[model samples]
Target: MNSDRAAANDVDVDLGRLFGSLRRHWLGMLLFALISAALVFLLAAAATPKFRAETRVLIEQRETVFTRPQGEEAAVPAALDAEAIASQAEIMASAPILTKVARDFDLASLDEFDTSEPSFVEQFLTIIGMKADPIAVTPEEAVLASFREKLEIYRVENARVIVISFSSEDPRLAAAIPNAIADAYLENQRDARQQSNADATEWLEPEIADLRERVREVEERVARYRAESDLLIGQNNTVLATQQLSEISSELSRARAARAAAEADAQAARRALNGGGSLDTLPDVLESGLVERLRERQVDLQAQIADLSTTLLGNHPRIRALQSQLSDLDAQIGSEIRKIITGLETRAETARQREEDLTAEVNRLKAESARADEEQVELRALEREAAAQRELLESYLTRYREASARRDRDLLPVDARIFSRAIVPQEAYFPKVLPLTIAAFVAALLVGAIVLLLRELFSGRAMRPAYAHGETEAPSAASAKTGTAKPAAASPELPPAPRPLDMEPAAQVPTTPAGLTALDIEKAADRLVANGVTRALFISPEGDEAAAAAVLVAREIADTGLRVLLLDLTSTGAASRPMLETSSYAGITNILAAEAQFADIIHADLYSDCHVIPIGTADPARALSGIDRLPLIMNSLTTAYEIVLVECGVTDAAGIERLADDNTQIFVSLIDPEDEAIEETAEALKEEGFGSPVLVSPVGHEPETVPPGRTVA
Candidate 1:
């Protein structure tokens, strides 16, 4: 067991051994790296070097102030988006442009593009029917394929610039091809614009002539219709009759106003005469020259009477004569007013006659205007038709002029221009000898080191046994020398008891000893606690009842104030049933199957401080699917508890081998001390390099009563 613990402690990697392996094999590794770098250098030197050249074309509206159309000088041209730039790149690599470049360069005759004969490997494959004969193609097709392979066109990221690149064995040809492609693409755009202009000119010429004739005919028809209908436009673009009617209407309105004024004057004058009021009180009467003079005379006579009355008596001859004169003057003024009223009456009658004559003339003009309006509708229709034809003709003429100007001046410009011309490359683009050789050298050194390290590890020459503090190999040597094993001393809290295999050394034990020593549950538990065993794997060869020894021993250890866990790996719940509250509790199988976590599966033992995991409700087959995780589970349990007891029912040494580690103890539990299967199992475990199995019996330590809802099986 001490030897096994030393082997387990030595399992970690030793950096010193790895460094020693590298030191011893470094010369060979360096030589291998040198050879790899040399071969890479030679390959780089023998490979054909390719030179690449690039030309850039900027996609934009190329029209300058002078070349741009009228009224568009200040207009912003729509920018070419990413998709448009990509489309321009595709056009740069179009078949026509590529073919033109290929022909101009005579690419088909170049040795790089030669495809007349099949390769030696191809011929061999064809002869053996391993590969079918290749389909034949023309020289042009072969050249195009090779040219396309060498050419690369792509738009610069987030920009309206296209980069055209070509690779070739000849640096001059590489540079020239890209320049030629750019020139061809520009020329193609110009040709397309010119062709469009030419097409427009051809189509518009006849159409313009037809429109001019139609316009002339429509204008003549309008003129003839105007002459026949007598609907000539007069003032304000109105027909002649309509104009005359408007004039007559204006004159009639004035004449009626004059007549109303004259009648109003006559009526006002008559009302004054009848009401005994002075005629001068009326506006028209006051404005009249004769009436104004009469008013002044009356005012003078009143002043004179006022003065004479102040100085003369009424019976005086002189005063009477002056009064008589005043009477005569008043009578003269009255006669003049009567004459004015008669003139006003005559003027009003003359105004009435004039109003009647003007009204009759207006009625005659209205009839003429109505007839002319009817004719004007048809005339207006003819005029509209002529105007539409004339407008269309003008538009056609304008377009024709523009098209003719473009064709004559040859001012078409492409939207793209070559901004960068390709220059002959001075260096090859591929097979950088220095960098590649250095990389290969470094890579090979790493690979060689890795290979040597693997060899050292697999051969186990790098491993050296490790021992814990205050521990040594003296115990193993003493056991070998004495040929008898000493029993582990019991803990201070427990009584010393007989140990199972202390009577004979493990090496001298027979395959089927008839008088092998046996340990009751208490002594076995004390032995494990004393020896500080972290893991105890119980193999029950005598079936379910024998599994109880692992449970009892776990409980005994837990009672000593040491943490202990019993993991049931048995097919039945024999070992766990007495310690757990229920047989249906989740356990190791559930943990392996990932159905339950540790917190859910670990349960308190009913009668002891030990925790117990039952055989579990999960499917055993499913649990075995992840049985490779058993070691990890045991490691975790061992970390949390001082001792982890595993009851492996009816299993052999091989079955429990994965569960054991450096601090593990192996025990064969049985009801009978001399059971044949136990002896065979102990031999099997010994041959498998395990510590001699400790014999433990559960007969006297069985729990008197099982927990409720559980059976011991």
Candidate 2:
């Protein structure tokens, strides 16, 4: 912090010295300043001015807070600070605010949105190097979020009065935005309140009634399923299902009888065919009781055989005798069984009747179960359809009632009145003319003052004096009486210069070191070289690089026939650098600084003409900022050759003026074509003299005459 103060003090001293320089050479500074002021004023006039328009607004709190949904909070809110509210008003003009405006204005649809297709406005913005970006929105927010950025709302100092303003190319648009913003905000509030009411009605009664019907219908369906399936109130139906068991038992008895009869028939036939004494026929095969009796007898015989076998085997003496007796008994039993079957037809008939009855009973039970299932399905279908119709009727009735109730209570809940409508803008809110102009002027002035001050301090010169050097010294009394000039409006900045008595004057002084004198080709070249012109970038303002070109030609003579290089830098693709002479390490400034050898960058011509470099594609603004590379390039190039010719066809004051420094010898300049071309150029030369520079005229093409009518055209 102390260092800063000291630096500030040093700056003050430097400023003092600068003022002293200006005091001694006030004539030069004044002349330059006058010319500058005139040029600025003329530019201000000639320039397609941005006329501004503004609309003002006042935002008052609404009667009630707006809610988006029932039982929820307000969707729209108003801030308390009056000035901040004004800012909100200003936001009405921002992109987030104006996206709707843009949609209203068809801004996005403009050809500018398409890089290949440009509209008039889009093309204009492109030429001016400007673009618009999309705005961001916040969560749960439905309007312009960056309202403050666009809207300029301000409360008069410590007061409730708010000023809402905006800017646009069209004054009508600027005026409209503020009113639109306010209207939008109010409309938003009204919508929220209305939506809340509607939502409340929608959620409150109808939804619950519909849910009740849904639950009732779904519940009834479940209840009917249990009843139809005979699953009464959590009771199992498995006990009633047991009737199926008796039916299966009856069928089993019939099957057993049929199997027994087939075996008895087979035994009888075998006995009849094997024995010499044969039965007349296989008798009463249909009589199943006879077959069953044979099976029983066989069972008993097997049991008796088992008892005998337990005692002795047939192969054994005792067992053999028993086995012979059993064989004879078996042969006789087949014939006996056949005779029993013929005589016992009634038993066989009884057995057949029993089997038939059991079969009939089983079949009847199955048919009854099928009929019951069909009846149950029909009952369930009828019950389900009835429930659906009842529910539908209930829902329609409920909706009708609620809607009728809402109609009965119909009322406008929120009051929305237009506090103000969009009005024609009276002033531009952005690029604020008064404030911006002042700011710009201050900035330009500060830069000018700093530059002037620095030059004065380092060069040790006076600004403007009451007496000239050629004039005889004035008597002390007369000199005192001459008095200082009114101090030139006492600059808003810069400290006062100390009297000559305060500090020792420099040992020597320059004649007109402050600015340019008469201009010529060589003089301009020298100025450019002094300004550190190594690799020149020529941009012709009036589509001609004549003056800068002449300077280049002069530099060529100094090159002594070495392979010199020139590079034309312009959008027109016109190669003007061939007119210059220069020894170069590299034609491209960047390559030269990076120590690129001349042979690499310099292309020798077949005609032995000086090598000319062509301008590569680059954004002009970005390329110009690399100015520090110039010195390094100059140092490298000048050593390889006699001279480095630089021709810069600068037209803008910012460009030429930016080149002003102690290193340069002079500033060669050209004039615009006009009726008073010579006079204007001469006057401009006088102003340049303040900078201690050289101004150049046309090269081989001297001043041309044009009739008065043609001049302005």
Candidate 3:
């Protein structure tokens, strides 16, 4: 408990001593700070102030009504993004726009922008070869360059609005430049649109005339084809030949039915005559009436013969006459039947002849219909082609009319409009004297603080009282404070090796005990180089005091032109407080978390070529998360720097395990040679493959002042 309290008191005393040093030199620090701030104020007052003016233009997707056909909407382009906005900015800042503005304003003659007349100072410097003479260029080019340099263009967030800014020594010129640029931009847009419309008209006129001639030609060709093919359309749009074929087919069918009926009648008549049946059944035989009469006469003759034969003898004259009449009647009936057969044959022959004539006509009409149908197919194809051409020609005429309207009216809508015009600024936008002066004061105060602190540190009187008093303590008293303060075993005597890499001799040690003095730090750097120890850890048995030793040693090594980095692993400002102080915690933990880049977090230290990475308020748990990456980080640092000195403070097994490698050098600070705590630490490091540790005496005492009873490693 007393040890913990004592450690806390030591921390308070360390902080108090630092503040006390600043307080003791307050007047000198204040004087230096005032002088620096005053110098900054004088320089700032001499600079010329520049006023800025801006104009806002809105860019949109739009087209004139005359350019588009009726019922057709204007095409909207794709949505604008960062690249499109930047493209617009480039256009506004282009040489053409700047040249136009310069020519109109006669900016070539202005003293502020004229490059032909170099300043007296520049001319003198050029003569001495300290500066180069201005390049010879046309006045137009010189003015354009000056105009572009002062011009600024940016887009409004989430909108298609462009803001053009111009800066100049004269407020009126600043205002005039942006407004002139905007007007020129609008003019360019108008001219571009007009040119496009004129081009459309130029191309469309010839095309429309060609289409009109083509329409007329196609119509005439269609009429000529119809006439030549003889494709006269009838009902249902059929050809006349096809209609004739249809009529002939119907008449032929009727004629065939009539012929069949006649043939059937003729066949019945012939059958009656050949079979010797009664002719009365045949229509032709009945119509004649001769057979009926013959039959009636025969019946009369038979009755007379029968009556006569009853009274008269055989071979009588009356009987003979009656018999002859009967025979004659039969002959007459046969004759009549023959005549009827002849008439039926004639009728059948007439029907067959009629059927043959109709069939021939139908066959001829069918051939004509086939020819007409084949021609009609070609005729329809031509008609379709003409129809399509007519449609296309009509469309072209419509578009041509719209283009003509646009060209004649000479009206074209600009895509952008000046929504806000620039006004003359009342005050300059740069070299704000008040804020700069205040900033200069703050900067100077920090610098003065650093100067005062460095002066106090070098004077050797700002160290803690313990550094001088503790050296006089007996071995028993030192042993109580440091648990391992017992005497150590002596090693074999060896000659001191020459310093490595031609290191300069170290300066004499200062009489201070806060940690290693400037001279001791230089010696440590020399020893580290001699041993070829690129990676080293400096720790105190108590942990808090070793940070200053590490920082000093790294700084001294950096002074020798070796790149060195001091890593402060302790959360307390032990390693970095003396050289730099920052509130934001960004270091290895940030690198491990991928939250920040190394360049963003790494800060330059007070000494030359020395960089320090403070443990900044990183969460201990988060920092520990990167424990496994410590070796990789150290290795990377070694490649970047000649030496990386880590202030491990009172070393933990976790800290040592992560940072230790085969060639690592371990240096420990000991207030007394026999401090038990430091000896135990050395033994632990050796067990962890660090080999034997190098012992460094605390500040305020030389190595020769140690008692003979004590052993130094």
Candidate 4:
């Protein structure tokens, strides 16, 4: 096993054989690599060095004052995103931009751009059918082609920056071309914008003029219609028809009130004159001077007559005179009352006449107002049309002024702007000389290495294992019957096996020519149980098939009510096979990384009593690097299960040695009967104190039935 440990450590590096191969072929391999590198370096130095220069442009959506509403800042389109910037880059590389750049630089006249005559070498190549002759083209086309070939326009990812790059043999030309392209693109955008505005102005001018005429015509029609209908406007912007109607109604009401008052006064005067009450109570009678004077005279006469009657006889002249005066005064007073009553009647009659006149005027106005109302409706409709036309004309005029002003002032807005100018390049962008040379050298060395390996393989000089004592010899056939057969010398370590005391000496389970049989699996399980081996790790010299065999044995052991757990420690999960697909947990990685609990990683439902912990999320190398905990994990698993079977896939002696203990049984599964390395591998394991190795070969026949007395439940 010390030899096995030595072999395992040397597994990663084939230093001895590699150095021997180098010793034999160093001069030839080094010469080949150096020559190849030197040739590549020379070619790189000879190639034309192209200087690349780039100019950055920013695409901004510009805003103009004319486009914005009053009292607000101008509203531009949304900011340019990556896609918009890319569009600007395409415009910079477009045919128009290239043509303008070419014209400005007079590129068509340069030999680099327009080579009219073919060189002698090119002519010879064309005649020999190795190359085609150059096609004839106009100077413009030639210039365009040459410009495009050197130009590269692209946008930065996820940004609004556009880069215009140009590659040329001359550094100054490369720098100058990118700047020129950027300038041309900006100029092109300005020209296009100005042209659009100019076109807009051209279209707007006539439309504004026509709208103005329409407005005038409609307004004139409204005026003429108003005059013909005689409809007028009044204070408060109200139509005269409505105003007149309102005034007439008010006047008629006032006139009726006056007439009624006059009638009431007249009736009161008549009642007073007829002796219904005192004439003084009547305002008309009291206001008369003649009536008042007559009353006073009557009072004086009555007093004088009373005095004369007392002083003289009834026939006295003085008494008769006072009596006559009193009679005259009374007649005058009565006449005055009659006159007051007659004046009241005349006032009432005048009021009635005035009311009749006002009523007739009111009725005439009402008819006129109704007629005017119908006419005003038509007049308002015409006015609205005229007003709409005037507004439209004003709007067009404003737009026309703006467009024309922009065209005249040449203040066109351009969205693309150059922000970074290209400078003269100090170095060539092409060739990448040093890197190319190094890569060529490495590639040549790799080829040499491959050749060396092939030679070693064909020459049969590859390293062979050296075993202790007679361990290198092949084991006899009888050893296979005992299940302790030493496998052929395949590796320095013999495959570890279970002790013979674990199994009864039963008839041999025949070996399959290629694959495993059920009898072989059962015998392995029986031996494990007999030896009280709760923890066993299985390995194979020739990998995959043995992993499958381990799975069969684990499943068979589990069916017998022995709690069996199959730990798929294989890198490829070949041991767990179809069972590995049922779970997502990492088998050894989970345990090593401590990412999953034991219960989380274990899937007990996979096979009747068999628990399987699959390889989990951690990478294989990371898991394997943390294998110091493997012993502890195995110990814990042994306590939980009656049989913990580990399918150790293609592991070295050191890996197996780490897990092997006094009570642990290790089985080496083999498929090929005549593998020459088995004996050596077996001897190495034996020396490592892993006990005699068991060689379980698959026989290509149906699995033997369970032993008569020991059928699995």
Supply every candidate's count of residue pairs whose N, Cα or C atoms clash at under 3 angstroms: 0, 45, 8, 33
Report the lDDT tens digits of candidate 1 across residue range 129-186: 8865545657787788779989999989988889999999999999999999999999
Among all windows of 10 consecutive residues in model 3, the one with the lowest summed lDDT is 494-503
Give per-residue CA lDDT, model 3, range 1-713, as digits (tens): 23321321121124555567688678877788788778878888888999999999988855666455576666655534667766777788778877888889989888888888778997898789886456755677767767777988888888889999999999999999999999998887788777887888788788878888888888898889989988888888789999988888988898898889889888888787678776677776666767677778878888888989999865898788778887888888787778778877887889899899999998898888899989988888888988988888888778777767766786566767898999999999887887888898888888888865664444322332231133432122123234433322231132222212111222333233332232355577898867767788877675565455676677667655444678887657567665443436467667665566666456555223467777765566876777777778788777666578888878644567777676777777554444567667777776766666766543542222223222110
Ranking by lDDT: 1, 4, 3, 2
TM per prediction: 0.55, 0.30, 0.48, 0.53
Each model's C-alpha lDDT?
A: 0.76, 0.45, 0.69, 0.70
Q: What is the model-wide C-alpha lDDT for candidate 4?
A: 0.70
Number of clashes found in candidate 4: 33
Which of candidates 3 and 4 reaches a greater lDDT?
A: 4
After superposition, the stretches of candidate 3 with alpha carbons farther than 4 Å from their true spots are: 1-15, 64-67, 70-75, 79-85, 119-133, 233-366, 384-389, 451-713
Winning candidate number (lDDT): 1
Give the C-alpha miss distance for residue 224 in model 1, angstroms.
Answer: 5.3
TM-score of 3: 0.48
lDDT of 1: 0.76
Distance from true location, Cα of 687 in model 1, Å? 40
Model 1 TM-score on a 0 to 1 scale:
0.55
Q: Show model 4 residue runs off by greater than 4 Å.
A: 1-32, 64-73, 78-86, 111-133, 136-139, 264-275, 279-351, 442-713
